[model samples]
Target: MWHFAVFLLLIYYLINRRNSKYLLYPPGPYSLPIIGNLLSVWMGLKNHKYHHKLWQSWSKIYGNILGLRLGLINVVVVSGRDMIKEVSSREVFEGRPDGFMYTMRSFGKKLGIVFGDGRPWSNTRRVALKYLRSFGYGTRSMEVIIAEECSELVKLRASDSGQPVLVNQMFNISVINILWRVVAGRRYDLNDDRVKHLCGLVMRLFRLVDMSGGIISFMPFLRHLVPKLIGFTEMKAIHASLQTFVKETIEEHKASIDIENPRDVIDAFLIEMLSNKENAFTEEELYVVSLDMLEAGMETVANTAVFMLLYLVRDENIQRKVQKEIDDVIGIRQPSLSDRSRMVYTEAVLLETLRLSSVAAMGIPHMALEDAHLGEYLIPKGTFLLMAIHDLHNGDLWEEADTFKPERFLNEGKLVQDERLIPFGLGRRRCIGEGLAKSELFMFLTHILQKFNLRIPHGDSLPSLEPVDGLTLSANPFSVIFEQRSS
Candidate 1:
């Protein structure tokens, strides 16, 4: 049986190699059979995180585009902006990965605008955009909530009395609170047992994603084998916990849904659930959709906020300028979302933060649906696509791209938004939470800065800005003092 299994795998690789027959592709290191390029690629580096220098090194040697084998999948990374746009085009890249994410799925039957395709995705995206437009995504009405959260951040920092407080916890609390209200219609204490457990589950799920070798990804049948063969008990436990949270939220929404008085996301989903019987979805879809939203909405925002906090601490000059912008525009009074436009420097700071952190370093991996030419390269159908967004963020496509100058994003020092600095991605499958996220960050960060001056603890130097190993890259354990500013 074992001999046959090995034989079958060898045959599969031979076939996949044939499928990868493309001459226009960028140069890559030599690949070996069975293991293809995995052994050589991973052998030298502990994991991809430590291998950051590898990407830069490879770019110098292999041009902007390169190919490698990620398990059974063929990963083609586009490093150049032209290549990025070419791949992101709807005609070339139409499909997405069907990873373990599909198997562990649990959310509201409605997929958040993030992962859905066809009509389901369209409906969710349209509704979300329309609803956000009305409720002030980057507008003033929504800024009230952000102001409150930032106020809390300031209060928490002041409580430290210039002592260093680990912002990982604070950052998580603020973003989670915002999402809690926006999506779930509830907020839990920062130290709440369930909140802590949820964080743990999210952290573990991300870890599983990070170190998840290509073992089971190639074949779902291998899930059982890989877990037992590799001991993925903790990952399973994390999935179980996450699944439970989604299930509980769904059940709660089902019980308390009011058709006429829809408020937060739960009520909104429930209303859609009850009103549309024929075209309606089931509880399973509901659970899965909710899970997707929680993961996308919460994960990115939390990571972005946390890193921005760390960056502000390290770069005190930027922090002071942002606070000055906030004070000039919003005054001692709380900042509403509308204030973002009035405060150019504050908006620029947020943009700079997004650029510098590059939290999702390797943009969400997408899969090609058909054979297409991206730039000069001929990409085959079903090839996995990962763009070097970190490089793009650092590239000269935009003025002052590498510099953390908010002035570049401003006109005569007035706040402005440019689509070119696209951190949320572009086209149809772009992040649905883009509008809400910008609002959350802008309103929250400026408000916090206005009330507290963020500074790294003087005792230890600031943490290096090197990326982490997980799907979401964050500054490693770093401490910052949030000294209160007199009103």
Candidate 2:
């Protein structure tokens, strides 16, 4: 009787295994029951870079598109340029996952532009683009605003030029000022306690999100059950703090809001709120949208600028080349948008910096809206998608892919553009702040290089290039000594 039962159990196991094969999920690391590939993911999160490296390895084993069962959710990681292009552009894959953590961040609803999808996302995105463009988003007028902000930053740094200065917050303050001007029609003083506190909160939020991996992201129940243990308490506090700032700003705007002549993004949004009462627009939505702008706009540009400085200071040759290009083209006059066309090497360095330090490494995750075919595999409805940007940028497609070679972006002494170089992402959901970011990067970097010679402080050791693992990759805090350059 025991032998007969053993034979029956073996038959049952085989039958289930065979049935599972017919599910048509893309190939990935074998997942255990219930927990699914959570352990593998957790291990990767422990070392932030490992998370990206693990995905790259899995891509090789499972081909370009690989799927993993991440707890209850199905995750599909798409690698390679062609695959990313195809998957990123597909409407079926454009939806963002409505996970527990995702909704909670936006006041328990999909109220913001970054994570929200469907008609609400479409409507807000459309309005935002329209108004932002009207307010000189990608134009020469925007360059003038950024240049003026850069000049203020330059004066601030000039005061302590020869000393070793921590530039992390300095970059944050400078970048935030430009966005603040665009959005609120005013800039915060660098020494303002409120600005300092806000910057600290934003940094903490990014760090917490990175450390938790998918724990805080996917499982909302843990937040309620073990709030302190899982960082949910701290996360909520940060969210509330940011929300308070946005609310206060909006209230101030409301007091002076003009229906006839809007001052900035806040005023524009308020006007829209009054005009389109029946649309998805709301006061709450405006708060979240402003939060999104400040968070996304500030971090991406600041972090990338910091990383660019880190790279240039480490390699003196690259720095000389960029500085020489700036001197030749712009000749110490404030770098403008028009000079961007002539600064070939400077442009290449910026491109390479962006490629090497992909700020939004994995980008905000995309959801599979419905069952769809990607290449040969069938991606089921509701599967979460992560564009393997880290893998795509560092793939075999680029020669010397791992090295910090700016020349890769240059050909015949001219900047060479590649479609695969998507630092700001692609498709309908590409970062709305791309143009603003590019303008800031060019203006700030050119101004800094033109004015100062960046170096590791005298008698100090070189800082580690390894980034702090976060929602966006940022260089570990380091100091640089800037010697004023003679024109």
Candidate 3:
């Protein structure tokens, strides 16, 4: 028994030594055999609220560019602006990881813009953007659609005057309506059960993805052996439901699509599909792409808006200042994209909210398509790369990073763009819906502040700014009393 134990230990040492000769992976925590650093990483991610901070802490020990092994995959996390810029600029680092989680979510293949990479992603993104622009995505006409939803939102809130309400719930439908108008050429009624169900599924899908970590992502065999233990079953059900919803919408569009004059994004995509049969333009891919737009469009902007409102409610002085700006600039009229230039303080507040919350936190992980050099480290082909955007948002790059100071984004009372603030991410994989999202956020926020004063419910104490941990950082649901502001 003693001889056998010694032999096994010798074999393990030799294997590690042999593997180390080929790849000079960056520094990371001590990993265990087979499992590597999965257990420790899982523990850190389990605390979702502090996960980004936890990654930052790890970067302190492992340096800005660090590497870890999660099961069979080599994971690299890049921090700070300079190092992140170095990694993101390389085309070799543009691939999306084909892990179990990514594959499963994208219908057993790389299908959509979010997780899909290479030719498929490029093709779909080009078509989507072109059509979206043609249909007034970033134009004044788009703001008209958003402002209509904002008006409806104000009316909805007014109907329940003096009641404590979950501000996200109020904003969710309005935000979704904006995307729906862009994507499907129609909007769902706020009370529609179909919209509510789809929203719930989208939220659940993100939560499940965040919770599982390596178990569902890297370890595929475990999912089959113990689906419930690793949340595989639940995630599959949500994905299936979401896919069905998107498919139904696509089919409905097909039946009514006018090839001559495209109505919305889906119709535009179908028109492109007719022209480019050789490309990755398929009905199934369209479903996934449309679903991606809907999910990202509604969730990120709405949550950020809610977080900004939460911060404003906590600081009445800030709220008053923002409202005063809104009142002065566009009094008693719907705020437009044209008015955004004059609303400097409001823009600053939104920028600060994005910086502090870091909604997507790490953003989506990038995969190495070839052996790459990031600074002094060698990232082997197929390795996963994650940019610590949260760290950049909270790093030494900003003064008083912990405090919620919108003034950081203001230069001499004018809103100035900062390169360091990358909430929508950067590089080839930067969010395509950024233009639409910015429009929705600006219009919705200006409209709300113009009409109402968001305050904590009469009996409740001010809620903490600490966000709920998930795929995206979201404020814990809190009731807000929307008091109609006196004219």
Candidate 4:
């Protein structure tokens, strides 16, 4: 029976191959029957967490545009700055994948802005951006919220001065609090156990899945066959807890909702859902979208801030230089967006962190909306798009790419903006939280630097600059002593 099944799969693969044999697909390694490149890709990702680098090495052999097949799904890994920009900017390559693992977190369907596509995604994203802006997402008001959080974090760290702080998840609470202020119109205490629990769940979720998405994303049948082995069970539990948080928040908002005057983004979305029954907005979507914002907003900013601190602590010279810049520019005043213009070296440090870390390395996979030509190769309809953003940041494009040198981003003390370094991604699918993230990172980092000196704890070695690889790059578990600055 197994032999017969294999025979049928071989015939099926042959027929599909014959159909596309004449077309010029991007070059790639050979794929076998039925499974395609699934086994090889899975093994590579499982053994080495450097998914982007693995693809980069493959791109070297198969040109800049490398192709592969995972089961029946066609994937195109596009490398280089121009090629990534070309695919990202084009409408033909703007769709998100609909694989089970991709949508499983959002209740087994593409409901949220991150994983969603088509007109519904457009409508929801439009509404989200509008409401987010109104609730101080990109405005000075947003900076105020971030400053408040940063102040609280500084206080908390100051209280624990000279202690070995596990700084890995240190920034999570503050980052999430800022997001909550914008989204739910409420903030949690710095010591809130609930927020800490959710942070733990989110970190676990990141490790369970990645940009390559593991075997379960393509071959979902294994989820039922070996749910525990593939992390399906734990993933669902995490999503459930997170979904409950969103649902409860939505309920709270609904009880106090004033449709005439929306207080926050949730209220605004609730009003839209309530007022327009004919619209695409639904209760489930509201929950999922809220989850999306919370999950996306919390992890990236916090991780990047932690990475910045790690880099600073590892190099006293760099940290002191940044502090010197901060001292020269801001002096005693609280850090603000207005100060960002004058603090070039500090800005370069943040940029270098974003580039070197490249947390969302491969980024969310994009799907082809229609048959298209990417450079010299034909991208058939339904092809998955994976841009090598990590390579764009660390590849041959930049001199001393792996070295965490902020000076590369500076020219005569003025920050040099590089088009190749797109840590927040690009084009229409760019991160909506870019403005908020920058504000949070700037405010948190500057506030901490202004108030204290980050140092490796006494008698302890420097924290590893190498990040723990996952869906995003995170600083490995480490600690920093917040020495009170004598100014």
Candidate 3 local lDDT, 292-335, one digit each (tens): 88888778887888887888888888888888998899898778
Please give the lDDT score for candidate 4: 0.85
Cα lDDT for residue 11, candidate 1: 87
Quote each prediction's TM-score. Answer: 0.87, 0.93, 0.93, 0.96
Residue-wise C-alpha lDDT for candidate 1, range 1-487, written one tens digit per residue: 9789879888887776676464555567777766656676666465444433456456667877777665566667777667777667765585665555434443312244544555665666676555445434545555566667777766666677588787665666667776566666776665678876687577556645442224445444566666755325666677678888878877787787777776676666567667898876556655656666667666788788887787777777888787777777878877777665577777777888888777777677777777777667777777777777777786667666555566676778676666556687766666767887888887668667777877767778766776566666666778877777887
lDDT per residue for candidate 2 within 339-394, as digits (tens), equals 88888888888899899888777777888888888887888788888887877787
**Per-model root-mean-square deviation over C-alphas:** 3.4, 4.7, 3.2, 1.8
Pick by lDDT: which candidate is best? 4
N/CA/C clash count, model 1: 16
lDDT of 1: 0.67
Candidates 3 and 4 compared: the better one by lDDT is 4
Note the Cα lDDT for every prediction shown: 0.67, 0.81, 0.81, 0.85
> Which sequence of candidate numbers ranks them by TM-score, best first?
4, 3, 2, 1
How would you encode candidate 4's per-residue C-alpha lDDT over 1-487 as one tens digit per residue? 7589679878988887877632578888788888888777767767655777678878999998998888767888998888888888998899998887788877677887999998889988998889898988878787788888889999999899877788888988888888788899989898999989999999989987667666677677787779999888998899889988889999999999988889999999889887788864888888888888888888888888888888888888997898888899899988888999998888899999999888888877999998888777888887889989888888887898878899998998688998888888889999988877887788877899998888888788877766777788787888888998998
* Alpha-carbon runs more than 4 Å astray in model 3: 1-17, 20-23, 43-49, 211-213
Measured with C-alpha atoms, the lDDT of residue 99 in candidate 2 is 68
- The ten-residue window of minimal lDDT in model 4 covers 16-25
Top-TM-score candidate index: 4
